[model samples]
Target: MSLSAFLSARYGRGFRDRAQIEAHHARAFALFRQRVMPRSPFYRDLAQVPLAALPRMSKARLMENFSAINTCGIRYDQALDVALRAEESRDFSPMIGKVAVGLSTGTSGQRGLFLSTPRERALWAAIMLGRFWPSLARRQRVAFFMRADNALYRRLSNPLVRFQFFDMLTPWQDHLSRLEALDPTVVIAPARILGQLALAGPRIAPQRLISVAETLLPEDRAAITAAFGVPVDEVYQATEGVLAMTCRAGSLHLNEGWLRVERDVIDPATGAFCPIIHDFTRESLPILNYRLDDVLVPDPAPCPCGCASLRIARIEGREDDMLWWPGRAGLRLVPADAIRTMIACLPLRLRDWRAIQRGNVLEIWLDGAEGDAERPLRDALADLGRRLDCTPPELRLHAGLPPEPDAKRRRVRVLPA
Candidate 1:
């Protein structure tokens, strides 16, 4: 579908002009307010304030009122039951058309259930296709990587487009074999996984590469782009949903039609956001002004891509992921991304490293390197301390790094005494 036609259908033709986007927002917001206030008893009660007077909603508040927020005819308990059954049966789309329900594979402690309407799904697909492959012809194959096989992949099919799913949990050799067989034009996967694939060097080739799920670390980005011989498009998607995607110029662009994001900049010391979200596409569950637990920094400049949609720099890990360090005043929480950046900056030989915090002491575990590595790693850790305004505590180096049981690896671990 043409962008103009899509915009007209969603926000009316008047909104096609850049000047009328706000009017479109206003109209959409009004409809959202009306729908949620009456239909969603959960939101109505939690959002005691009138729709006009309601401030941005928070994650905590949404969880607290989880039962009352769903506008879909299904009850919360019923939906949960349906979701669990669907998940077990491998029929993930059981509740899709009636009420778009999808399970969040929560790497973070809390697993969430997200819902949307078929209309929202269609809009999401259209915006995604328009933004990501504006110039591509109808016939193209896209290879997607995720931990589990999903029924949602079927929703992306069209007569001209084909999508192949690659399971990340499967062995790397298996993926390589599948990729050789598929020969997809486009490839999408997490940055770390793609970096691992890049280590093989050049057997896999695609016209375009897209990174999603995790923050694309600079070193990994450089390596993958070099290996693939194509600029890597980083997509800012999370369990919450497909938040945003990068344009041709590599600027992260918000999916304005699917959702609206309000960023909360938290002081690392206090692991909480000020809280704010104005989700317009949430009908099954009213996500009005929810506070996301994740930390993010809003982009300071408008994207050169010409879309007015607001964008954010990579999500710098969740609040709980921050490592605690001993400080003169008290214990201070340091963002894990800071440590990751420090490690990335170091010129040390290492396969993988994990930072573990126990009370006042910090432990650094190294996987592929040994004894002589202390100097550079220590210097990097010391530099991180300086940047975070905390003293460099004793760093204990482990001979080997241990893996976490979960499929999702924890780069930083906080251990209890």
Candidate 2:
């Protein structure tokens, strides 16, 4: 499909009402099922199967079944070798023929390799430009900060758009001067780096600031907006596919226009759900009924922008971030959102922080303001304890926290098995 024509038809729908969104999504889902079920061996036998009856796919399952899981016939071992070499050499142009090959940090402990056809890459770029670009007609200088790179991300560069990839492994301080020099019209980075950039003043102004890869914590968003004087929009994407993004009104709306999401409820009361995503846009690696570990909370109210796609209230860190401790009867769990809420409710501006649960002990790291950290810290702990209905874990405030292992930083890490 022609990029311009695809964008016009896919995004021009305006998604004015819920009915329209549903109609668009249904058509997309139906087309995807019909196309993928026949072509992909992973899904061939299930052609006549209902989606709900299909076994859910996960990162582990995908990796184990990698060869069969992909319609592209690319071997997992070969792809991993290529992706790793690219990362090591800092040259991402190499691909499995015309396909785009990229590696994920393996946020869940196992590295993931993703493949995309040339057509898929173009579609992704077009979709990104269509959804996130400040305007279609106007030229844009986009600075994308990511740990790795691929031809897919670079494909958008042209006379109309200047796309630059800032490697996260490189010294960030060195890039500050270049950042000021580039004067990017749009800046995209993980939430942590975005916060860091915001904190590193004589601030550079950008028409648009987008947070990707990491959860856009409320505190981080507030800080970015305060520093940049621009609304910090977010793109909710993963190795799975481009799942969701912020609409014009700045609410995070699921990209239900091109993907269908099945909510696996973790907590109905909190509106927290683990999504089973079926991405119609991904042909190389069709992600049908694929389950992810991340947790998302849906907003009940309709967006002011009138985007009928499922709107998200917040992206809770991860399902694994939930802490558990032994109680009289059994192990009691403290929801990840509860811990996040406690810290967010505190009066301090959390510069950088991490919460790690090691058995019955909770290790808290804070790197903000010098004054006494105990009072507000204690209050937050009290709230956490009250909510969990158990004595809070031994809270120890450490002076320094460990550096992040990858581009994706988890504010909350659960260490105990």
Q: Best candidate per TM-score, number?
A: 2
Question: What is the lDDT, from 0 to 100, of the residue 285 in candidate 1?
Answer: 72
Clashes of each: 5, 0
Total colliding residue pairs, candidate 2: 0
lDDT tens readout by residue for model 2, 1-417:
647734753466457777886787778767777887677887888866767788788887888888887888898898999998998899999998898899996577667878988788788777777666777678889898999988888977878899988998899788888888878889989998888898887447798898988888887799889998989989988889878888777888888867889899986557688999877778888787898988888998988876678889888767787676555545565666677778777776756678888877788888774667778888878776666666777888876566775557887887763
Q: Per-prediction RMSD in angstroms?
A: 4.3, 2.7
For model 1, what is the error of residue 175's alpha carbon versus the real structure, in angstroms, after optimal superposition?
3.2
Tens-place lDDT digits, model 1, residues 155-232: 555676688877675677778777777777777777777887789763666777888777776667788888888888
lDDT score of model 1? 0.65
Task: For each candidate, give its TM-score against the true structure.
Answer: 0.83, 0.91
Residue range with the least summed lDDT across 10 consecutive positions in model 1: 8-17
